[model samples]
Target: NAGVTQTPKFRILKIGQSMTLQCTQDMNHNYMYWYRQDPGMGLKLIYYSVGAGITDKGEVPNGYNVSRSTTEDFPLRLELAAPSQTSVYFCASSPLAGVYNEQFFGPGTRLTVL
Candidate 1:
């Protein structure tokens, strides 16, 4: 699988703006996650879903939301964009049955808030 096939390469948002970061992966996995990393900082988990119709919050869930009604799409909604939310976001997926639990990552979306 090519993992994440495509996404907007860049996005610019102003304070209070809202947008959805679309993430789609091959339909072979049962787990998906959303994470964001600020400059020189480690990635922070925003949300994750183990399977369809089951979602859970992660370390950083404020100002963000996720839904998994299907196995292929896991979109992250960023509401009321803020400067503190400026970061590169990643989408990852792992199969239900794996030996090492390796994850496949998307190319990442660069979001800037002003």
Candidate 2:
């Protein structure tokens, strides 16, 4: 299984531009999440989905949107990009949310905005 994969390892977007960060997992995990980490900061959850058609906002969902239409895919969209949005984005999945489940993270996408 391809665990998790994200497109465009690196990107540079201008202010006000919009882009979609693609994420897909082949493990058939029911729980997926999107997170962003800024320099010298811990990762902050942006959005999460327990399953298809069920998504909830997380700690920092202000500048982003997410949707889960299948067990293997969860994509995040960023609108009106800003410099503050420049960070490393990660997509992760877990079989469950409790202690017994381990989250598998993607390689991560690094974005810079000007």
Q: Look at candidate 1 and give me any clashing residue pairs.
A: none
For candidate 2, lDDT tens digit of each residue in 1-114?
778999979999999999999999999899999999999999999999999999999999998988888899999999899999999999999998778868899999999999
lDDT of each: 0.89, 0.94
TM-scores for all candidates?
0.92, 0.96
Error of 1 at 95 (Å): 0.3
Model 1: per-residue lDDT, tens digit, 1-114? Answer: 667743776899999999999999985789999989888999899999999899999999999989998999899999899998989999998886457777788999999999
C-alpha root-mean-square deviation, each candidate:
1.5, 0.9
Q: Tell me how candidate 1 scores on lDDT.
A: 0.89
